[model samples]
Target: MNPTHHRRRQLRSVGTITAGAALAAVLAACGSTAGATAQNAGAGTSSGSSAAAGQPVSGGTLTLALDGDPTCIDPAQTSLTNTLSLGAQFTDTLVDQDFETGEIVPALAEKWEISDDATEFTFHLRDGVTFSDGTPLDAAAVKANFDGIIDLGAASFLGSSYLADYVGTDVVDDSTAKVTFKTPNVPFLQAAATATLGILSPATNKLTADERCQGELVGSGPFVLSKYDLTSQVVLTRRAGYAWPSAAAEHQGEAYVETVVLPIVKETGVRAGGLQSAEFDGIFQPAVQDQDALEQAGFTLTSRANPGNVQSLFANTFRPLVAEEAVRQAFQKAIDRDEFNATLFNARYAVPSSVLSPTTPGYTDLSADLVYDPEGAKALLDGAGWTVGADGIREKDGTKLVLKLLSSEATKSAAELTQNQLKEVGIGVEIEIPESSQSFKVRSAGDWDYTFSGLTRADPDTLRRDFWSGGQPNSAAHLTESPLDDKILAQKAEVDTEKRWAIVAEIQKEIITQGYDIPYGSQLQIYATRDGVQGLRLDASSRLRLYDTWVQASS
Candidate 1:
């Protein structure tokens, strides 16, 4: 038999081991097991027949449309949603999450064990794995990846946040590696399943962070980066001799599609039209208005609620006018979250009840303070010594009650609607939509009163990455040292399942009570695919996992 056939035969005999049974059981006590079922229920509408029931076939090119150019190809440096969407195709994490049950499963690492204190984790690497560059994937490579991310510092916002408590890693043997943390990092295991912590080859790790961001990284995933044009497109070719795959994966060998192409198409109309005309196999972030038409045309629309902080208008308390707690509370009570979901998202998105979404692991309902009451909002402003002028804008001490709201082109419509809503409550909002890169600069400089954004992750510790002032400074509300920060620290330090959740609940309540994160609604990462495509799935972080995706032979 040929070498490829022999490898397949060997893989068939090696059974897959799925981990995190205890973790899944513990989470079930906190929330429903079918967390993603509600979001995926409308996947292929009743009017259209399911296209996922065909036999898998190989040897076809899958053309996917991206909303914008990926910010970076390096997993550690990628911070944008579009970048994560593409990075998932070429990077393999130590672990993977079960889409249906949210359980951690084996991926690059065959299995792992967490210390009783939850401060240390040891992983057993899979044998015979090799990077696209033909470099061996071993314990040393994993250590280099983690160490490299920590060394990148602020340049790698996501990576730095993920490894904030990381102390060091020790290679126990050729296949065994132990990772140590300063504090009890209960979320580190789940984080290991994310692309932010994906391992790169030793050669790739040796390059400077800037060089890796320019697409010089190598990974051991099913696809290899064949061509990367930062401004235009990215092409990936299937990797041969890849027998190992995650336990959640449908098949264990090479990907069904030989080549995958991701082209940056910023316009929603163009992407939707291309998918409709069969010019593209799939499209990311399909317009809400186009969902009905796309489904009616027999395309499948799949979505999952991102599992971290909801999309919110974060009030920078450090700003002058917003420094007043009353004004910040008024901003939270003034806008109608239900209206925003209805008008902008067509109610397809989930209305968030807390700083964390329902799909998040430690989510708790704190919606009592999030209700919309324009009169209450006005009363709060009035009590704060702000008087409405002839122009309908409130003023106090000769300063106009105007706040600048920063956003990107994608969120311009929602920002405009928010402007009109706040205007009714005697607050003036100036909407500024800047270029993507410049938007980051504006946020980092703290030049805006409010910013629209969200962070995606499967663990509740994502709060630390966003809210911890000592970490990513400008990502979240930019609130330095507060009672909520203390609670977040407490939650991160505790490892007991129930006790940790109690602390997490209190943290969410404190965030809502303080009005730092004024959540609008939960955001769903939506993708639309033409009929006859099968096996496409969304991982826990709501990124597309196309390893098992196949194009069914045309009938």
Candidate 2:
């Protein structure tokens, strides 16, 4: 199945906001990246509230802290959702995006076009441009970077899945190139704008994959890689002669600031404490506690409903209890989403109903109105032949209602919340299972009942990979793949825009109607910044772009 076949497998897209809206506005602030914004769970953030949040200021440094040290800084090799996104803040894509509208405008490749059937795309590479290393960014350079990524195969899911086919790119001229897919691949441009496809210089490709472990990290963006030590941190400096930037960017030459530092901090308390103590200038992250504090601290809270992040409870269909359609429905019914939204997350999150959020391109409110109906849940379980046992748990065919609720160190707290709530429905939930990597193996191996997991991407096609039949665990992975899901995905890819929504709506209905996994909500996005940071914007893709920032009293 192609990546676009069942687009909603990834994060859902929410509604759109016009330009000049809070998030789309790139205003200057006193502190620049030094300012801090509050965070809340499931509730993502983009600073708003303060009118000056839209003001502009330049000249200073921005200190950032990431969740962890990256597995690899070679954007093509790794796929830590946030790692590549952070790279976007420092690297340039073939095209740029408007966050408020998600429109693909232009970036490195000045302009592009598509064939009549929409199967081919030709990009006119910009001239007078080169990587930080001074190597020209010609059409040949673009082909080498992408072709090399595709060669990595499974190592680059972003390239493989996002690019659709292993098709080659043709260099029409020094400043122009055309790419041909096996079939209609309109979203290629959108994917091209992703960091995974950031055009690297010839020097980048020359370095051994391991040697290039964040090596030199030169790009045509406003920031140049100064230092990248996996165990330490990734440091960057402003490009001295930089000029090209997003049209919305202000003071567009070399950035006003001199440096950008991204440290590694994983603990929630540490992240929050570090932000509050002024130990860091800015962060691209979300947390339940920080957002609550920000609200009370009078910090700006700018958020728009988008299917940005995902927190999923994967129901192991191979397990008898979990395989029962009614039992899966029971889990959803027992979940107090509002309580989770208001209490567990400090009212910073929203419970998402559809597999693909309403914000997704083909989104619909098909299941948005679904309610927590315990009575209905119980009725379905009764019909499934599950009866209450002596220990207050249900049993059928000598199997108890017990199911392993797998979680990692990161999600332990969320698991505890799940355990507390699920007991009310007479379901036995247990934690202390394997970690994420292991859980992926176990679930794909069909060794467990369910695994708590999630995925986030900028496009609707992400849904197809996660839920569609072909996206099932690989054969060697020994996981679930459904023919029904496969059929649904096929229908979506060929359906026209107007009619595609109808198909997507049905798919959402089916996902909810079957209740394979209980989607808590698309987790919120948040960041903390000093009051002085400016020229910060987050597009629908959740990319971090700060090339236009300036500090008030920058050194």
Candidate 3:
């Protein structure tokens, strides 16, 4: 037999192991964020055709349409939804996290152990796993990737955020590696299950960050990147002789689809039209207005509420106009989240009750605090010495109370709606729509008074990642000082479930009561798939996982 055939035979013979009893109990108790489910027209219905019977017959191409180009295909370098979805197909993480149960099961690593204080994690590599590039997946390879991620520094936003305290990974042996952190990282195990911590081939360590972003990376995933064109499409071909699969994944061995094609379709209408014409098998983020029509036209709509941060407008506290607590309070009170949702989203979305999404763990309902009170807002503005001028805009100290709101195409519509809502209370909101690539740069520079975005993660540690002022140079809130910082930090170290959650609660209350995060609604990832597109589902973090996804044969 050829070497490839022999390797495949050996890999197929490899057995899997269950996670440690201690770690499994902790993870299971924590539970996952909301499970991602595929429902036709938001009703519980499978996307696959009824006529297509028998087994999952594969060997077809699955073409998915994306809203924008994933400028970087490197998993560690970006947490953007598009890039993450793409990375999930071509990369594998150390462990697999259950979407419904939050159990930390084996993936590339067959088993793992956690230290008593939760500061250290030891992962045992599975036997007979090799990267598509022919590199051995071992303990040394794990160390190299961790070191490389730390070296990427701020460039790996999500990765850097996950690995906050850098100690290093120790190669105990060829298959055993121990990861250590300076501070207790209770979230590290769950973080390991995220694509940001997905393992890459050690050979990729030789490439610069830029080269890696340009798709110069290799993984032991079921699929390998065959073509990556930033302007057009990304093509993933099923890796031959692949055997190891995540324990959380529904199936074992190779992916059913021979090839997966992701084409950038900037216009939602264009994507919808393509799906209708059978030009695309599935499309990401189909507009709310188009959801019903697509479902009526025989397409299935799969949606999962993105956990962690809600779609919120964060106050850049450094901005002059928003520096005063009164102004910030007025801004929060003026927002009619109900109206915003009814008007813009056809009331399909759940209005935000707190800084964290309702789907997130430890989410506290602060709807009473988030009540829409325009008169109260006017009172706050008036008391702050901001008088409504003849132009119907608030003015104080020879300056119009106009706040610059930074937004992107994704949130531009919502921002515009906010502008009108704020206008009612005599507060002028100047929406500054920036290029997608420039959005982060502008926010990081503190050039806007308010900005809109959301972070999706299963854990509440996402709050610290986005809101904690220290170490987070790109903190949207621009919080120089706050008690919330302490609460955020405390939650990370508290391993006791009740204690950690209590801290998380205080953090959410602090974020909203102090006017740091003005939430609008839950962030939901909705995709439309034509019939016969089976097994498409979102992972715990609301990212697309195409491993078990298959395209049914046409009758």
Model 1, range 51-140, lDDT digits (tens) per residue?
356577887888888888876778788777777766777778899887655678998899899988878999999999889888888999
- What 10-residue stretch in candidate 3 is worst by lDDT? 41-50
Off by over 4 Å in 1: 1-38, 41-51
Q: What is the Cα-based TM-score of model 1? A: 0.88
For residues 46-77, what per-residue lDDT tens digits would candidate 2 score against the true structure? 32221234545555677876767776876776
TM-score of each: 0.88, 0.83, 0.88
Tell me the spans in candidate 2 whose CA falls farther than 4 Å from its real position: 1-57, 116-118, 247-251, 298-309, 366-369, 435-440, 474-488, 491-496
- Preferred candidate (TM-score higher): 2 or 3: 3
Q: After superposition, how far is residue 39 of candidate 1 from its true place, in Å?
A: 4.0
Per-residue lDDT over 72-113 for candidate 3, one digit per residue giving the tens place of the 0 to 100 score: 889888878888878888888899767555567789889899
TM-score of candidate 2 on Cα atoms, chains taken together: 0.83
lDDT value, residue 414 of candidate 1: 79
Q: Could you tell me which 10 consecutive residues in candidate 1 have the lowest summed lDDT?
A: 41-50
lDDT of each: 0.78, 0.62, 0.79
- TM value for model 3: 0.88
Q: Best candidate, lDDT-wise?
A: 3
